[model samples]
Target: MSNIPPAGMSAAEWQTRQELAACYRLAWHFRFTDLIYTHITARVPGEDGHFLINPYGLSWDEITASSLVKIDVDGNKVADSDYSVNPAGFTIHSAIHRTSHDAAWIMHTHTRAGVAVSSLEAGLLPLNQIALQFHGRIAYHDYEGIALDLGERERIVASLGDKPVLVLRNHGLLTTGATAASMFNTMFYMERACEIQVATLSMGQPLRKVPADVADHVATQYQSSMGEEDDVLLEWAAHLRLLEKIAPDYRD
Candidate 1:
């Protein structure tokens, strides 16, 4: 068993715990979770260069705030936890965190839609509103088996190249943001984009792609719209409320 402090034991830590746990349940609610495969991490509040991640082997539906494991930039589990962190998962997340300091939260998942889109030769197309928003930002990292090798970190980081979202070719999806909610929201939209692409492709007809110039304009517009702090907080709170209604156990 892990010696996890009770939720609300520390105001900031508890808040991080709530947000991280809510992210897990919300991932589950959105059908983004797969057993213990995905991970959602939050930078420790007021703790420099440290963060918390799901204890390896725990399903998203069963994760609670306190049950999460604490780790440093090197992926070392400094906290008192019976479980170990997944090396492959840590390799991907730690690399991104080290590169993107503003990314306080990171989400990675392997949904069917995500993998399906990743296997496509065209990658993400500018065929719809959701797809066009990712026109110039999405990155792709060719899969090298499981992400267990630390050497892959350099390549993964190189491939992401300042982008907020990455599609692990032959694998799944990833998104980084300033908050767990924001990261999850990004993944939600990215996966939905992939799902939409797959559904559209299955129609056996040509896709109605938007013009490159228009896609660029819309992408810039979304980037601006996401800049407001109030908007981010409001969306975060709304997601938390939804999680509370759907999976109250995440707060336990």
Candidate 2:
């Protein structure tokens, strides 16, 4: 792959590609990736209905800024590239992006703990502080086998509604944000929450739930903290610095 930016691409689109690439590297750092499967997509700035996604065969760690593929909402390539997009995975992502304006960035993961929690009947429990952020704000979409069917698109949109997170029953986890930083932040905390839940359940003891009112209060506090600024920007910058130390080529 070439490190040079594609010719004629707008600076804004190039920057979005870089950020989306950083998100993939960060996901790998957090161990939220499942081999070459799953996807992280971001809306190309200034380009309506166009988005950036990883090339089909690359693992999260292998994805680079210039290697990302630009695709329209229909999963068709909007720009030339040597790589192809995964239509099956793009089904879920395209559906959400087309249906919701707030879904500027979407992330899906098949981590062990995320899938484990999705299999549970109760879904995500409000058993800890991190989990509380999702209280009453998360949506659950039932599994309907592999998501290759285009018909499942409407249902995926309906299941997601106006929520930021979706727990794919018997499947895995999905999160979205208006920016890549916010979406990455959501996935990081959510994946950690799932890991904690799984570890807690393994002790085979009853788990204490945070009171409903308190959980709601905490969730409210988190929402209020966002106000006008993207609260995750600073943290995302820190992540970029860390990535520079470990995998600087992702920015290529």
Candidate 3:
């Protein structure tokens, strides 16, 4: 809400804007966006504390590089924009931002596959290597309906403690990262993992799962060998290029 920059915003702030905006467009292209419901936020470039988020009510595909609003950790609109932000969106994002120092980029979604998996009593069954990667890292936050109450922040924060990803029970998914790319990549993997797990479970056959030690080894290798650059934005760039060929209006 305040106009004060978290630190001082720099010329690079504009670049962060473009990338974050591109992320939104890419989300729509992936069909990861849920109308105007989900939110993706990025910290302002060269600024220590401020971030940019979409104004509520705008379809994710409608977001443009220049249309994002600046806001502090408190969730007030700091910049001039025609669009408004949802308090619930701010509530979820702000809690993570405040508690997690590594959360430079945060994303949340309610994809059908994600919500379906969340509702299942089993919750993200380890039916494959992907699910196993999150064997101990993923946290679960029971849904409290629309996430408007400030009281929910405590539980949300506690559930997400030290974990990079969270599956909000009967609600959706949340991911935190050191960059927008990493967070997006995490969400994509989590959603896919859930989708496959659900589909596999529906088959009603004996399910094959990875050994916990092997899963941990693979996850450690992924972290050490691949590193952060191997995230969604690399492929996401290709996705945006494809969107340009088809739904060019998303750039508007």
Best by TM-score: 2
Rank the models by lDDT, top first: 2, 1, 3
Question: lDDT score, residue 22, model 1?
Answer: 86
Candidate 3 lDDT, 1-252, residue by residue in tens: 112323544556766676677778777877888898878988876666678888788898788766888888777777777888888888888788767778888888888899899898778876787776676778889878988887888788999998889889988989988876677778878888988987887899997777777877877876766545754567657766776786554333
lDDT of 1 by residue, 66-97 (tens): 79999998988777888889888898888777
lDDT comparison, 2 vs 3, better candidate: 2
lDDT of 1 at 234: 81
Candidate-wise lDDT, in order: 0.83, 0.89, 0.78
Q: Cα deviation in Å at residue 227, candidate 1?
A: 6.4
**Local distance difference test, candidate 3:** 0.78
The backbone clash count of each candidate, in order, is 0, 0, 1
In model 2, the runs with Cα more than 4 Å from the true position are 1-5, 226-230
Residue 195 in candidate 1, Cα distance off native in Å: 0.8
Q: What residue pairs clash in candidate 3, if any at all?
A: 1-76
Q: What lDDT tens digits, residue by residue, belong to model 2 across residues 1-252? A: 233566887778878888898999999988999888999999887788988889989989999988999899898898889998888789999998887889999999999999999999999999998888888889999999999999999999999999989999999999999988889988999999999999999999988999888988988887787423445888888998999899988888
In order of appearance, the predictions have TM-scores of 0.91, 0.95, 0.87
* Order by TM-score, highest first: 2, 1, 3
